[model samples]
Target chain A: MMTTPSSITSNELNFLVYRYLQESGFTHAAFALGYEAGINKTSIDGNLIPPGALITFVQKGLHYVELEANLESEKFDGDDDFSFLQPLDLITKDVSELQ
Target chain B: MMTTPSSITSNELNFLVYRYLQESGFTHAAFALGYEAGINKTSIDGNLIPPGALITFVQKGLHYVELEANLESEKFDGDDDFSFLQPLDLITKDVSELQ
Candidate 1:
């Protein structure tokens, strides 16, 4: 089906499921699916992040917004000349490094 | 902080939250966060998919696996000569077209 048009195959979909299970910390499900589907051949091991990362991700984001609100109030209120050369001072690490 | 070490900036994290809210169909949340963070400058608009897509993704994947099981039992049982030149008969579309 790789040569077909407008169709998605099972392999691609299975990969998504595998990743979902892993990321959600359904380890047994991930393991079973990977084994059955032969998806482990692609070396998807050891990439599982703790399921709590999702909560951390959201809370961290909220904190950032709060900090931004405080900073903008203090720093940008009277500074008509202020322009963001880069939008936010977030992302200290390089994108490649994160990946 | 962009040049700092061991830090993730707010913008990066906010973008993630924005995407999460959008993809999860919390459009109002995504919109609010994007507006506050000035993330809309990057053109993340109109990429929102309904929350149902996640369910559909899993169901479709489960169906694929079921079909594969049926096919393998029928086609591979007696075919010791059988080797998967390609793993599954999935993904009719080119990867490029997907993106």
Candidate 2:
């Protein structure tokens, strides 16, 4: 059972992500645009990101996150990849309710 | 390169879930509570709920979702499990703003 923080609404966390990514003015838009139009074979959606799938983002080196929504890659702390998604927001409170 | 809806803040959607589940008073609290307390072996957190894990919820049939944050579960629409999570809220609009 997933628990939620009382102060931040989960919805707000997702919005923060959206606003941060889009408003950051740092969008890799051309690439992202191409990705959406199917010009790129790659995907960034959670459903598409399988477990253990490895992705390399240029200077970012090899990073791992479950890409296919499944955990296929064996668990190992010494693996060559420096990959992981930020933990999903656990805050349960509505952001507006915060002091 | 994930996409998001423009009108809805993801935060709001999460709140909708909280309101519905909590206010609705349909919590599987005992089971969920046990899972949370580490007094139970099962877990419901996204981190704990992997990509292709098979969970059998009583009378819910054998269901499959990636369980290990990795995609190890074979991809086939004909699988025997009746398991699936609701697609994460894809609403692009804030619920309050909705007409």
DockQ value of candidate 1: 0.03
List model 2 lDDT by residue over A42-98, tens digit each.
Answer: 223434322211101100110112221112222322344423432122122121221
| Candidate 1 wrong stretches, greater than 4 Å | A1-4, A42-99, B1-99
Candidate 1 whole-model C-alpha lDDT, 0 to 1: 0.39
The 10-residue segment of model 2 chain B with minimum total lDDT is: B55-64
Leading candidate by DockQ: 1
For each candidate in the order shown, give its overall lDDT on alpha carbons. 0.39, 0.24
iRMSD per model? 15.1, 20.8
Cα shift from native, residue A66, model 2 (Å): 4.0
Question: Who wins the TM-score comparison?
Answer: 1
Point out where model 2 deviates above 4 Å. Answer: A1-65, A68-82, A89-99, B1-24, B27-99
Residues B5-97, candidate 2, lDDT per residue (tens digit)?
Answer: 212223322232222323324244222322332333323243432221111110011011212111232233334442333312212212122
Query: Candidate 1, clashing residue pairs?
Result: A9-B90, A9-B91, A90-B9, A90-B10, A91-B9
TM-score of chain B of each: 0.36, 0.23
Chain A of candidate 2 compared with the true chain A, TM-score: 0.22
